[model samples]
Target: MIFPTPEEYTVLVLSLKVGLLCVVISLPFAVLLGWVLARKNFRGKLILDGLCHLPLVLPPVVVGYLLLLLLGRRGFLGQILNDWFGLQIAFTWRGAVLAAAVVGFPLMLRAVRLAIESVDPRLERAARTLGANPLRAFFSITLRLAAPGVLVGSLLAFARSLGEFGATITFVSNIAGETRTLPLAIFTYINQPDGEAAAARLVLLSIILSLGALIASEAIARKMKT
Candidate 1:
């Protein structure tokens, strides 16, 4: 294995863990936000839309720094979380997850929103006419129709999280077995004089993983269509 060293393995595992955690944390919120943005017209909708897309527009380092400020021990929400629940998001694995989620969330949300918007509102109305409640109609009609988009969004988010570097490194640092992920590992390898081989291995791994995810997403989308 290219990652013959225990440190490399630790970094690999931590990276995967952070990526998975980011996906799980962002999935539900992405769906809800996507549905709302696609279907509902509310006051301040544009503001909410802009906020959701802010991370995409901002630099990753800036986002990480903002996260550090907002979730630091002395920060407002951070202090409440620490005092009430003893949760710390600074320089930790959880912090890495937060960083990844913040960056990946916009992609997921955008995908899901497009999917929801493509769904015909008439279908929802028909379900409601059959005595289904709004929530029930959404699950039965809107969700089913938007499954492909959701899958695509999830895959995109997962891939994005897996490759996250700047925000993760800035927010959590490149601590082995904690915040070190694939991109961070690659960067570490590249920093060394004789680290080319290791970096190449990780780079190839990232490409392969991304390709596999794209293939899998297409397969799932096709199956849903059939």
Candidate 2:
């Protein structure tokens, strides 16, 4: 109602956009990584798993800096992207999505991996014996069985992305319309002398969002069980 101002609304929408984009961009990769970790045995698997989780252990600021180095215009990959594709990530909404994906991916991957591992390999084998291909068997048996975990993982990732601040701010800066998100906006409001009310509103919105996600995840899990 009389809560967030227009600027705050813009930040909220931007945060949701970044969060959704992060989820969409990372879901396929997260599912693949999850399946790999859950089912595959390969050399350096531990290293790969650790690398996927490095963002979780490292400081958000450090993660942000790393993204900046890798995706900044002057960085190697960034330079190539700019020169070859005319794409830019630094200081843009896309950069915010990238930061959110980097941080949220581990949670999604872990959940999906656990879910995939929980599925019965025998069922997949049975599907294969019934003339199904590997991909078909996986989708019909393994992925169907793991739907609950996938939903949980996605919700967790969404929640994490919604709250992302340090990495996003570092990689994308705090541009008002382009990159500012709810957490960044809250931080900005807190910095101003008369911004306590707005900051409080944003904090409340964050809590509501987190709670809603949890509730929705539980509902999805229940629906999948049925």
Candidate 3:
């Protein structure tokens, strides 16, 4: 296939950038949450699990709205952040990253939790009995054992972020250079006169990217199982 046009190329790159940033920012926290959910039997565990998976079942638009209420210019945290740190997140690429992260987080978190659960706890305990600290055993044993799931989760999150539309558009307003990811660009094209051709091209791109990411994820999962 011919390369995408300069404008289409920009949107493509932006989608990747936003998706990767989302995963990078959220992965650490997702890993921690996944480990906690998998290993711990604490009070409120049910509530915590529900909250971790909330985005998976909630409407994407509602998630975006909730984010806006927390991070908008006049929002409570938003006002504090702006006044104290001069940091602005809403309506920027940073906000796009935040939107993608929130929407994609549950997928990553679930993948991690399942991966950790599949590991035999005895492996980590053996390491602990051999003089490894809990943290060391986790890093050397449980974490390594769960690497495949973490990889799959990362790819899945990347795919989800690439296709993210409702939350991203609702939060960031699709400014061309700053926040117009592939999905936003596709949406713009579909609504314009004689824009179907361009929209079709982007839609094709989206399908290709999604399939590629999932294929890689499946490959990793299969490799890990072997």
Candidate 4:
């Protein structure tokens, strides 16, 4: 019956917030990219797919550094965003969300693409022939059939975001009560002489959260088949 200390609780909440936000922000884009990769055969399509999945193959630190270069305060896009909208992402929770989203996006995209590909294209064509526009046919037929995969992908991305470490730390560093998520908190604890107990607790919590997401994803996939 051990309760989480305030610090642990904060870390937990922040981690959940980041993970959920990452999923919500990235899901729509993943769905669009997945649909395109599965259904379209245009020039440079393979290149686009490879770029989308590059994060999966690259080192997390490299990904983070790239993000920093592209979004740092003085960076081209970062400067524009800061000047135009007064928005900042680096060294903040928002940065954490972005990092997690980028890293987990590949998994989300792959799951959705596979799911959509499995659906019969003819169903969408049939809908189109029935006077529905392409967008309507996709939403009503293709996307509906692929919903389970989308759900599963969301869960998988959530799980990945929860465990995100290298990229987050590299991009945002560790700021207590700010950008310090569960992984960062655990890392901090492990480095301290009296932090083992806290680290262990956080580790267990991380396991629980990640395991739950994975289990839920598997359950959804099974349900989709049946």
Candidate achieving the largest lDDT: 4
Q: Which order, best to worst by lDDT?
A: 4, 2, 3, 1
lDDT of 3: 0.92
Determine which window of 10 residues in candidate 1 has minimal summed lDDT.
1-10
Q: Candidate 1 vs candidate 3: which has greater lDDT?
A: 3
Which segments of model 2 are wrong by more than 4 Å?
1-4
Q: Against the true structure, candidate 2 has what lDDT?
A: 0.92
Superposing every Cα of model 2 onto the true structure, what RMSD results?
Answer: 1.0
Query: How high is the CA lDDT of each candidate model?
Result: 0.89, 0.92, 0.92, 0.94
Q: How far off is residue 5 in model 3, in Å?
A: 1.3
What TM-score would each prediction reach against the true structure? Answer: 0.95, 0.97, 0.96, 0.97
Better of 2 and 4 by lDDT: 4
Better candidate number, 1 or 3, judged by TM-score: 3
Give the per-residue lDDT of model 2 (tens digit) for 1-226: 6766788788888988998899999999998999999999999999999999999888988999998999899988899999999999999999999999999999999999999999988999999999999999999899999999998999999999999988998899999999998889889989999999888998999999889998999999998899
Off by over 4 Å in 4: none
RMSD of each: 1.5, 1.0, 1.2, 1.0
Query: Which residue pairs does candidate 4 place in steric collision?
Result: none
lDDT per residue for candidate 1 within 41-91, as digits (tens), equals 999999999999999889999999888889888878889999999998888
The predicted structure with the larger TM-score, 2 or 3, is 2
